[model samples]
Target chain A: MASPKILIIGGGPAGLSAAQDITDAGGEAILVEQEGFLGGTPKRLHYSLLAPDLKPVEEVLDPLIDSVQQSGARCMTGAKVESVNSGRNGFTVTISGGGKKVEEKVDAVVVATGFAHWDPHKKYEYAYGVYPDVIDFKDFEKMLSDGNIVRPSNGQVPRRVAWLLCVGSRDRQVGKFYCCRLGCAVSIKQAMEVRRINPAIDTYVYYMDIRTYGFWEDKLYWKSMEEFGVKYIRGRIGSINRGEDGRLIAMAEDTILQRPSEVPLDMVVLATGMEASEGTRETAAMLGLELEEHGFVKPLESDSMPVSTAVPGVFVCGTATGPKAIPDSITEGSAAAIKALNYVRKRSIKVQARA
Target chain B: MPIHEKNLIEKEDLLEKEKAVVDGVDVSGRWNTFIRERLLSDYHEDFVEEVKSLPGGRTVTNCWQCGTCTSGCCLHTDYGLREFNPRYFIYLAQIGNVDELKKYGDVIWRCISCNKCVERCPKGVKVEEVVHNIDEVLRRRGVTEDTPGSRWDRTYLDNIMATGVLDELGLTLKYVRAEKPEDFTRGFMARMAVKIIRNGNIRTGPIRRRTRGWKKMKKVAEDILERDGYASAK
Candidate 1:
């Protein structure tokens, strides 16, 4: 039988990893990404270092992207998967770009449309978009990668910084109840980086719970405290505004002391959480895949069959299913690749038996 | 609008001019209260390290401030003392904010050792031990003074070390004499001394009686207390 073709819709850690794994396993893979580049959010944001390990982004993603490119899998950049129509032979997929449309026949589909950073502006009290000194995780990553820890307001090294966790995640007022899962570690990592950039900055993280779940509870959160002196205060930020000194002032009740504390800082970092990206939403709609309440692609059985989507011959992985870390996304990418490859094998068998 | 959680602001920081006029405009009382802005704390950076050096304080850093320990605290649920929250105290100590621990020094001693916090704590913080250690540190730093009850305990323990058995009469006399010189004129110690003589409950004599085998065990008890960071009686 000819090589089974698999369509991987995304070019992120998960999509790239899936494409690499499938091609390495002797299955033909076609990778599609909407951006002109292939490296997903980390590349788009120019992420300097990843969390938990603090490895340079290029060390991990660069090789993954390169390996997938060299694996002989057809790759499409700056294009979108317009539609998918299933038939007895397999799926007829439409790709549209540059006012052109191309069709391909694929044995299976893997939707790895990753997540988007939650918009901090939704919590208007934070003054994320309005204030020049305030920035979210996405913007901070880019700023950090640019190698300057200066306030946008004056471009001076910040003397005091405050990281407010749970800006847009774990907040019912915004209709999002699930924990962002990555913010605590991300905030801790950023706080460490800020302090490393300038040892004098008094960095404080105000949080209700430092949910640095998994091994990160010690590796990232506690080490950030013992090694870097990044102070942790049990307080939820009430609001942020410009003070008389042109510095940002954050108001919070240091719940430990049961007294309100007004923290004056040169910069305020909102550890914004992740949500379903627009691509994730659009792909789900186009493919007739079920989405959970949070709009992430619904799995066949999230606990046991996590990579299998609601539609047969279709698989989903990474933040496309929910908010997850880079390592987990990559793992799910390989997992989805294996499932897609198996489905193709079974399809060829069915066709041969029918003949 | 500026966020002023007025209820959470300290009472002393809310300074207001009662019934005053400023520039032909009335600015007085709660209507024009001034909320004092707090400065960043230099934090006793070694506070957690100091606590860990003491007995029963090693796990203080394990706290994540989940409040699970506080939710099941008997001192909070039964005694109705809101200041006796284990989670809050642990967080304060962890942050090295000794200034904030001032208001909570006395309450730390009130821990009943119900161990509810230890059982409920997901981080394995020995909550009961941390509470006692905080009390110990407060007393050592003179943030808290010896209450009459604590003074009585000191006298009682002194008598125990002197003699294997507890001498109630010696305990009473020692406690009375150890009272402040000014306390002699008008205090429970003065009244108690007078009652002891008036009733002839004790013969006026030296506390020469010492329990047998006390020397061997007294050394052990003193060793334990010293090792636990309590080198003195009170």
Candidate 2:
């Protein structure tokens, strides 16, 4: 029968990574992305070496996308699968956009939809929507790209800017107690970016804990704080409000100080947590896959195994499994592709043996 | 030789005194009463029987007190208490000392229930669930509501059952009252004074409960409670 059709959802590092592997393994594949382009958040990110000293997103991803496109795997941009139904043999996926409703049959599916920045609107105390200068880390990045990192209220470079790490993360009150794996390091990277832009800017990171695990621990945290004088305030932000002149005012009980202090800031960027992409729930429902409490597709056995989902035919990799940086996502994506190929090829072998 | 001999004689005298006390008590029998008093109680009996009836209750006894599960837990990550390991709690359950378990009740409540313990457990102990049941035992014993954390959890179902929707203001009030009454006293007076100053509504506070779908939600919540039989005091 026609080469076991493979359909991969999401076009980010995970999706593209899976596509490359699937093509190499001699499987028919279709890679679909909701955005106009293939690269996901890594495209939006302008930080230096996330897993430090690793290849940059542009250097590594550009060629992979090209190779996957050349490998006969059809790339569909701005396409979304509306619904999917699976049977014993294969899956029927209904897609929309490009002025038409189309259907495709695939023998297997890989979910790599990745993750989204956790919404802080639910946290009313943060005054996210009400305050002009309160933006999530991603929005701050976009603002930085456009112009100076100055408060929108006044036309001056920020004297005091605060990064409230773990806004929606590691908070049981909000039902997300699990650490989003890469958030701590990501916050440090962002703070470093601000310092690089304007050395004079007073950067204070309000955190419950600084979880700089592994090699960059000494370099990122110790060097940034002791050597460069980035303030590591030990506390969680209790609330944030807009000041008279429109500057952001943060209220937090500095555990070290043992008193509540109001720090006036030109801009407050909440290093928001990560959650499974919006599409993951829908995709999981269609394919009869399991999702963990945080909505990430539950790994079959994450501790020992790699890139295996609960379902027999379906698999998930990268941030879709949990919050992961680009390098980890790429590695997981390749592992997931190998897992799918093994399943399909094994079935083919069984058939040949039976005959 | 006489001085050395005198020292040996003195050491022998001290050893005789220690042995006299040791011989008066049987080492094996010493633990029997302690175990019987706490372990054979109705609470311990019920906890053990209930756990045994559950899927892996028998496995709780199979634990070798390895302490691996506790070591692997994320609850010990800086904020957590080293003494509050779930594996030790399980061992306590196996030994049947309900009182010792009760003594460590607050620490058990300190568990954020992250389930890292469950995931890492080599023996597949439902660490969170088992600890949750132990917490139930503490609540039944009528321990002081020390913190809003412990009290809210104990009465969470009841609050949801009575009001239908979680009363945000009520929760805050309950928290303030349970944990820090002084903080509550200051906050309450401050709110009242602020209300008088601003001429805000005194009949109710700034945060009001949505009584709209509350009745319906309350009914649904009540049904769940009645089905679970949580309305009555344990």
Top-scoring candidate (DockQ): 1
Where model 2 places Cα greater than 4 Å from the true spot, the runs are A44-57, B1-234
Separate clash counts for every candidate: 0, 0
Best by TM-score: 1
In angstroms, how far off is A146's CA in candidate 2? 3.5
Each prediction's DockQ against the real complex? 0.12, 0.01
| C-alpha positional error of residue A22 in candidate 1 after TM-score superposition, expressed in Å | 1.0
Q: Using lDDT, give the best candidate's number.
A: 1
**Clashing residue pairs, candidate 1?**
none
TM-score of each: 0.71, 0.58
Clashing pairs in 2: none
Kindly list the per-residue Cα lDDT of model 2 for residues B138-174, writing each as its tens digit: 5645642444455666466555445445554465556
Query: How many steric overlaps does candidate 1 have?
Result: 0
